[model samples]
Target: MEPDTLFVVGLALGVLSIPAVVSSVSRGERPRIATITLMIAGTMLVWAISNKPGGYSIEAIPAMVKRVLQGFT
Candidate 1:
């Protein structure tokens, strides 16, 4: 997959994991799964950012997301 796509997927996963982490904590359950998910997401995002040409800036994320979404349509 493209680095941008990977970054987007990782970002989405990381965002989704927030609810899982919250729910797990609220239920008093071990948050192992949620934690692992977050770790994996972080790794993917980091990998993508590191491998991307010219790297990326936080300010460019919105434009990157827009470009990626446009490609899907």
Candidate 2:
């Protein structure tokens, strides 16, 4: 898979985990899976950023996401 894809997936996972963690806390349960998901997301983001040359810029993420999505359809 492409680094852009990894970055997009990581970003999505990170965003999704937020709600899961919040719900878990509200229910007085451990955020076990949610915490793990967040950790994996962070790792993916770091790996993707490191693998890309010169690293990614904040401005470049939207275009990167667009390109990755285009590949799926």
- Write down the lDDT of every candidate, Cα atoms only: 0.93, 0.95
Best by lDDT: 2
Residue 42 local lDDT, model 1: 97
lDDT of 1 by residue, 1-73 (tens): 8999889989999999999999999999988988999999999999998999899898999999999989999
Candidate 1: residue 66 Cα off by (Å): 1.1
Against the true structure, candidate 1 reaches a TM-score of 0.89
Candidate 2 residue spans exceeding 4 A from truth: none
**Judged by lDDT against the true structure, how good is candidate 1?**
0.93
The pairs that clash in candidate 1 are none
Runs in model 1 deviating more than 4 A are: none
| Number of clashing pairs per prediction, in order | 0, 0
Candidate 2: tens digits of C-alpha lDDT, residues 1-73: 6788999999999999999999999999999999999999999999999998898999988999999989989
**TM-score of every model versus the real structure:** 0.89, 0.94
